[model samples]
Target: MEYPDPKRKSNMFGKLLMAAAVTALCIIMLKHSPSFSTPTHFSRHEKGVTHVLVTGGAGYIGSHAALRLLKESYRVTIVDNLSRGNIGAVKVLQDLFPEPGRLQFIYADLGDPDAVDKIFSENAFDAVIHFAAVAYVGESTTDPLKYYHNITSNTLMVLKSMAAHGVGTLIYSSTCATYGEPEKMPITEETPQVPINPYGKAKKMAEDMILDFSKNSDMAIMILRYFNVIGSDPEGRLGEAPRPELREQGRISGACFDAARGIIPGIKVKGTDYKTHDGTCIRDYIDVTDLVDAHVKALQHAKPQNVGIYNVGTGKGRSVKEFVEACKKATGVDIKVEYLPRRPGDYAEVFSDPTKIRRELNWTARFTDLQESLGIAWRWQKAHHNGYSSS
Candidate 1:
């Protein structure tokens, strides 16, 4: 015992040398690897510039919002999966804002928590405008689970990432569908959220989650429950370009445009027997330009520890027949219309009471003329007949 064990001592010394060698190798690898280096795109963030994340920036509304933010000198980063969005839209933005640090696009699905976490860790975001979702009401009815997973679960993931990263501002793109056939006219913020379809239910669930989260956190939150969004960028830069396969379940504007362009033989009016003035369903059609204006206003008014819920729509309800006539007049095409029975779960009429938004946000639907709005959107559609595929 006094002499000690030389063999044991030698073994311990050998192990120590091996450990040091391994540690040195790891350090060398880390220093030389590009993967471990800071991302160049993130390094371009200006010191005082506010960076906004647009979740579905490749889609119609999200793209317009990004354009507005860029024009206002705010840094914009668009993250879209391109599942239902167009790469062409992203390209258009990039072309418009070619300067570095002004705009960036990340092709990522928010459903992936790990990817979202990576995005948060890499970049500094001042706010998030969440618009990525499967928005087809008919598709939501047939495939309820898809809507819940895409809209509800994905929103939760984004919120968690934002909270973890301490991003305090969020502007959620909600739909008027959450009101779900309200008993009264001009649905307000107080409308009971008894959603009728899976789309509305999923959005309402997301809204509830955001509200619950906001109660304890100091995050600034704005939920814009908008009516049927129509029109385009007004500058003819962006427009609705839903996939051809989804035409049957797509928006009425797209169907009308398709019929006008002769892509379809005629447009089908799904609800003809509703108890409206024209015996068809009536809806508040808000132009995309006005909708994006509301988003910008909401962002400007956002404050930590506060929440704003507003209905972004014109306080006027237009019937299906009226909209069709406007569309025909705008396109200057005698688009044949085939009237059909009312679709299930459809409300007779759904409009919004924009008094609160007007009083608070100081925003109103400037492009209120239905024919004018349709005409502007039709101009973009006529130019991009193939819908970004032409680009």
Candidate 2:
């Protein structure tokens, strides 16, 4: 302003140029830095390799799914925050598939948009199998917000990344709890979803978001609504290993195993008078092996711009008393069962029709025997009494 100071203006322009040059140099350095470099072992566009992203791949079901995908020769990148997932499962997978370009584990949370965006930007994924969510029904009732954020909000983040990256296929792991004590016996795909608990409600919300997004996009989606998932990897490569703190809210099989191992005094059988064949509630116990098979079949059958929803179960319901008897026989332990009052948000009976999945995907539960399934899981439990922590 003071008679056009040319010298000051020249110095200011020089400083601005220097700052711009430094920023450019820093970006170039970061791109070439080893820590920021892209993985060289695998390429997203590699020939004859379908790179699939398995969210929450360190968890029980997700880990098993990763094992199946790796065994089937698919390139897998596992992203998990390890909140409820075990790092040992990921280590096992890495050890099993030590070969480069076979498997990779990323310790990152989907809630972080920057981290998720970076993952999608770096890897050219062909498909995404989203298995990340808090699944405990009792816990969800106590902490509804955690379920909503982890399940529904995180799913939205995954979907957003998938859309931005142009990923075409998605296989979502849903649950039959969304049916919420339907008046019917076997639940079908067309069954109305009236969830009772926060867990089921959050999962249903995610399902709705996916459905609505698919209506406007070319994404191929398969939502597998599973019943009670039990058993292990069948080959003993992976097993359910929930944290000890969550034992009370964990799976019934886990409680049975704990009692058999003397970790817990005895099993607390909640909800004894649910108007079933016996006093206990009824559920369709599907083997984890068969459950993973359904996912694989879904991935294979997914079509662009199409949405397929199917219930994955044995199409038969077993009472809780029957399951306890089976577990007792499987573990060879008396496993004292103390009857308790009904837990919140528990349905009397919930199973699957499974007709649509069988007809369209040609998938069926091969391990329909409840005792045999429990036996398979018991073997793993006995071997690793401390779960994956000891291994």
Candidate 3:
């Protein structure tokens, strides 16, 4: 047999060994990555709430929050009309609840007095998280009646029902739109609301109703003024399912969807002439998961005086162009570029002060990076093409 030199043979063996070691390391890394490993964790248990009622619990943000509550051992009763929400989100909860008896779902709208009455009569909820509202600023401008009727009047009805039921605690989904164009850089909870649009006005009206109800009745209220709510469940469970007619920018998953389908040949930017580092609108985007945690904290605070308002957002403003660029990098998609005129009622830059939420509730936003949140959202969107409704 022809034998090679020992040095050459040793070199060949060493190369094979190195390649095997590298291969093993890569496998370990891939297993721990978000693609393979779950990003969500069941952190803590909720010992206080005997029963918590969630209105619009089947919707985008509501559904995820409901899931978190269930994981934390809270008895949740979801009241939804299923008008804007998906049944798939509900079904996921149906399966996960260890004891189905603890989970109750009332298929009723806040508009119906009888339905609202029935929910109040049956369940003795310790807290109520109201996510039920018609939330679309542009559409609200055109259809003010619908906005006012549903968001305002319907909220009044819910409050009346809550009062009747003696539900002492309430958490409302308010909007950063309530601020409109701010005189200052970052919007705080103390800023006097000057809503330029009907949707913002509607939210403000509902907030007023809630506050009024809290004053008159024995109710504690936490009004969460949300910025741009983006991202989805880290486990591909739930995500944004915006109304097709009212869907807008800020959510990178939807933009990624457009790129994946080749509907947008390139990134089509709406406006690029605004006064910012980039000539586009900047918004503070918070992850749906982090937002869920804030709601739980608000619910936990017992005393009536502890119930106050807080802004739920990343606190960092991300411009529209910057977000798009992040999407391109994350998804490896060449998003087309097309600049048009600026959207009416669009603020140049709207971020949160974030001091109130941290100081009051002792809760700080964990995911400050927009790209990471968007990355999670993009992956969830890629897997569930039809959104949470389809899942």
Candidate 4:
């Protein structure tokens, strides 16, 4: 038995008090911090750089997904045709990781079989995220072959190249439009796919190809059929900056932005006689940032023996009128509304169940608030009024 020294006891008490004070401070800071929908905290990957190939990497979704990969400490190679992609956005990605051999850009079109093959020959890709395809519904309707050829034919070329190079993992960017107008309110993956538009038809054809490929070969694929994607990088590093020509034919948020900046006289409420509460179409507007997070999760969970299809959405529908009102609040201007009859190929209300992704991938849409998403989008539009050209 030994008696405790007075000095030792005093030091021990002081250390305990200091630790308690620091823990209390941390708790207070966390309580006041702004909240974001977050995944279960863990290392995103094991140690090592994953070399990923991102097709159409200069486009809005592709670029954000590439950035997300870079943040996860992956080596990224971006290939784009520049026909409808952004050069300025590519520069932003390169600047984020200036170190050599970390982020590389190749100006090539997958439509060219030779160019696609060349890319696979030169680089050893651990995985591929495919985002190259014609997405304009209006244009697809006018020139259906263009959509079919680009989405179906070009996809075969890419797949052939991947098989030749032994790249077993892929994450395909699909759209909810593949489901068309479903009788159910919140659709599940098992919902019968009956696409009504050429754009949707093109994507569905590509999906069928991917599934067939998976059955024959030891290839893993995650086809994410997402709803409308909006917002920018919350850090202001990246955002949606489409080419000027596609501005009017853009998604709802971009159209609303055009109205805010006088690019268009006002926004169009495409339908106002639906059975919904507001007599308008309801859609799931998932944030771009959160959407990309799902991509990362899919990439991590992919295996050559696995083939999965998940709908990336908030599982909650926001009406057209609600989004317009949200835009007004975000931009601090009354957005002029032009009511119009229902557009062709438009659905009344379509959202996702989102249960599979949440249960499997542990992902959530933190920035699901319409006003908040619009506000983030408005900031980017305001900063770059002419889009990347303004830069």
Q: Which lDDT tens digits does candidate 3 get at residues 112-208?
A: 9987886676556778888987776656777889989989999889888888867778888889999888889788888889999888989999888
lDDT on C-alpha atoms for all candidate structures: 0.92, 0.93, 0.78, 0.86
- Tens-place lDDT per residue, model 4, 94-186, is 888888667889999788888888677667687899998878877787889999998888888888998998888989999999999998879
Candidate 3 lowest-lDDT run of ten: 37-46
Which regions of candidate 1 deviate over 4 angstroms? 1-36, 39-47
- Kindly provide the TM-score of model 1 when superposed on the true structure, using C-alpha atoms: 0.92
Best by TM-score: 2
lDDT (10s digit) by residue, model 1, range 116-140: 9888877888899999999988889
What's each prediction's clash count?
0, 0, 4, 0
**Candidate 2 vs candidate 4: which has greater TM-score?**
2
Better of 2 and 3 by TM-score: 2
RMSD of 2: 3.9
Query: Residue by residue across 1-391, what tens digits does model 2's lDDT show?
Result: 4597899999999999999999999999998654578766544478788899999999999999999999999999999999999999999999999998899888999999999998888787999999998899999999999999999999999999999989999999999989998998789988999999999999999999999999899999999999999999888878999998988999999999999899999999999888987879999999999999999999999999899999999999999999999999999999998999999989899989999999999999999999899999988888887879777
TM-score of each: 0.92, 0.93, 0.83, 0.86
What ranking emerges by TM-score with the best candidate at the front?
2, 1, 4, 3
Give the winner by TM-score: 1 or 4: 1
Instruction: Report clash pairs, candidate 1.
Output: none
